[model samples]
Target: MSARPEQREDRRKDPVDAIVDQWAAVRPDLDTRAMEVFGRIFRLSRSMGDRMEKAYAPFGISRGEFDVLATLRRSGEPYTLSPRQLSATLMLTTGGMTGRLDKLERAGLLRRSPDPHDRRGLQVTLTEKGLDLIDRAVGAGLAVQSAGLSALDDEQVGRLADLLRELLAGTPGADH
Candidate 1:
């Protein structure tokens, strides 16, 4: 019912190969070489994100929620931050963060309090339950990501990371 290693490898035709072939046949003058890279990268990004979300499902959190908790957890002592700070750090809009915060607060995973520094502003902090859950979520997330990238050897992965960093460095809003 399952494929052996060779059978699996044989069936995997580097999906982009087919895409390139298809484009080449229809548009003889067009150069689709970049398709080989971006196509796979797009698919890989989506699939990896899906797998990571699955990993969070058992912990009863979406990737967004996990990110919020994890960010708060690592934000040093008091584990607190203003809504604006959180939205900025996560690249989310304050409006979007409000929905997430409301959900987390209802779950008792985080709490909001009056910001001492700014009257009429609120700060968010993780509850004890949130801290514990995020600790486990982070551990599980790392494991899921690690397993997903296991096809690459250490040197290959390191090189890939460096290459990705370079690519990210040039992209707008990618945090230079």
Candidate 2:
């Protein structure tokens, strides 16, 4: 015997619902439909970010460092890109990128050498160690994410992705 629809609905109410109810009691004219949606999104992002950080921990890389290595690994054969290109692609400041590059290079995970095409530029390339690490780290991260989405069936996941994509596309400053 399953619970009634109204009973299920009551069980689904979360912290955001409580907040909305509080607002409603004080301000009946206020509309909180968007609040319910974004509040859950924010909470989900925070929780998943923590989980991802833990997933990458055993690889000796923080989530940000994992992103740096993953970026190079995804760049195809030779796994090289100019520092400027990396900064632009990662949407990170040049100084911030330099720090990550320095750390990775020191770890023997990547190397920096003068760009043959441009004397003033340097190229960053993933070493065999970096390549191996990213491959494993990516799998670990994906497993965490997959587990997180296990509650949703494939169809629901696809629908959620499409809706989120549409919402992100419409958001200002979210270009690309």
Candidate 3:
């Protein structure tokens, strides 16, 4: 039989391909397209997450901490938000947010102050140090990601991004 389109295009036998082949051998009746796609996505996420963790490590932050700092940095001037806002944006629980805030505050990377408009609420603001660290960390993280994507050309990357966006939009409970 002639090689499949994917096989003809690239003869690589990735882990996901190996898995699909095993399943096919055992149960040829099963359809594994979704498994193949999601399996590759899952593996990519894991591997990239590790690379990102390492990328942020030199700045003395984990991926989660980087998320917190990045969120604030992207918020623009004054770089302040309510604790509740931060929790919501990060999709983290209030307790979890508190732990991160405590650590960042202790490290002098951020500050917590009583909200002037709301006596009962508190505001979180990024310190100069936090902003500087996040700026550098973001660049490093992007470098690592760019290197990983170097295998694909610009058009291929764009197409992949569009496809992933479509998949994410259709996914249940995913943010629009």
Best candidate, lDDT: 3
Tens-digit per-residue lDDT, 1-176, candidate 2:
21111225546778888887777778767767788789999999999999999999999998889989999999998999998888888899999999999899999999999999999889999999999999999999999999999999999999999999999999998765
By lDDT, rank the candidates, best first.
3, 2, 1
Query: Could you tell me which 10 consecutive residues in candidate 3 have the lowest summed lDDT?
Result: 1-10
- Candidate 3, 18: how far from true, in Å? 0.7
Give a tens-digit lDDT track for model 1, residues 1-176.
11111225455687777777677678766666567668988999999899989999998999999989988999976899999989988999888999999999999999999999889999999999999999999999999889988998999999999998888887897772
TM-score order, best first, reads: 3, 2, 1
Candidate 1 lDDT for residue 92: 95
Model 2 poorest ten-residue lDDT run: 1-10
| Candidate 3 local lDDT, 1-176, one digit each (tens) | 21212455456789998888888778877778888899999999999999999999998899989988998999998999998998999999999999999988888889999999999999999999999999999999999999999999999999999998998999998852
TM-score of 2: 0.92
Runs in model 2 with CA error above 4 Å? 1-11
Clashing residue pairs, backbone N/CA/C < 3 A, model 1: none
* lDDT (Cα atoms) of all candidates against the true structure: 0.86, 0.89, 0.90
TM-scores for all predictions? 0.88, 0.92, 0.94
Model 3: lDDT of residue 122: 96
Candidate 3's displacement at residue 52, Å, is 0.7
Model 1 backbone overlap count: 0
